[model samples]
Target: MPGARRLLWLIPLALVVTGGLAAGATFLGADRIESDLTARTRDALVAAELPSATVAFDGRDASIGNVPADQRGRARSVVLGVAGVRTAEVTGQPAEQAPEAGGHVKRDLQVRLDQLLAAEPITFQPDTAELTVQGTRSVSRVADMLTAAPANVTFEVGGHVARVPGGDPEGARTLSEERARVVANKLVEAGIAEDRVRAVGYGDTRPRSESGTTDLDRRVEITVR
Candidate 1:
């Protein structure tokens, strides 16, 4: 009878372990789904010229913010179009007023910039500020975009570097600054007004990824102002 009792107890224990594993897998799967959905939705928003909008997800449902009142419909439409997005809730300023020209132009420029960087991010050689061939091309494209932008529109060229173990922080800062200056100089050579561009360096301070230094960490970002 004792053996039978122990067998019955072991069966429940096995069932409990199996159930716990299944729950863990389900949680992980949901997390992955949410992450994928967020990426796709952001890309879609950028493609639709709504890059300023921010997206957050609860399961498959998305909550998008920062969209202008006039653009909520379009933002929601694009978010819904992304596969696996079950629903989208868009919130922003009420659509009672028309969007101003400056606001519209800024958003347009940001969207184009996001699209360009997404396809070909500007990268530099390891431990140096030298631009790779592809990086030069990417900078050229950005310069072209800036030249076409409104004269009042200005941009900031922000430089960043990946953190290295036992590396000199001051050296990292200097390298990032040089990289920013290089990109800013190229933009000027491409006919963009010198005064319209500003350069700043963030040395291993703002990492895009926590999984150590990546190529993405050693890169430049352009922000419309």
Candidate 2:
């Protein structure tokens, strides 16, 4: 009788151990699946040249981030095409636009442009309208971004120069204008339509610094039109 009781107790203990092992195996398998999905999705985005986009997964659903408004559809499609992704949601995008929302879209593009230039300002050779190597690269990136923008959107390339003691205002204006033209031409060469861009020179009238002229004053700025 005592042996029968002992056997019953051992049977329940064995079952409990087996159940715990199964639960652990299931959890580990789930983790591995999520990891594989993340890597594959990232590789797919990079292959599509949307490396700036980020992704995260919850089960089979994916959340994609940092995708530009114009590229949202493409990013979502790319993610959804992944083998394990059941659904994809693009985050951080502007809402569906109404006809009256044109201004908002323009503003959003302007902010993006500003952030790009802030990180990588377009530079030129000393006192010449020629672009440096870095400046050329920056222009190329700008071109790519603008190429993705809406067709109705336009841009203004504004150039400004620093003020110096007894500097020739006329000369400054001419230099600034030439710089603007050079940048505009580079944009056109890179793929932007000429009709969509306008170049203007502000000369020393728009110094970025209130106290004195700095290197920043001799710079170029882009505005959405």
Q: Go through the candidates in order and give each one's C-alpha lDDT.
A: 0.85, 0.82
TM-score of each candidate structure, all chains considered together:
0.54, 0.53
Candidate 1 lDDT over 27-75, as tens digits, reads 9999999999998888777667564579999999999998777778888
Clashing pairs in 1: none
List where candidate 2 sits over 4 angstroms from the true fold: 1-101, 210-212
Over 70-171, each residue of candidate 2 has an lDDT whose tens digit, in order, gives 889999999999998999998876443324328889999899999998887777776778777877787888888887776578899998887888888899
What is the model-wide C-alpha lDDT for candidate 1?
0.85
Off by over 4 Å in 1: 1-101
TM-score computed on alpha carbons, candidate 2: 0.53
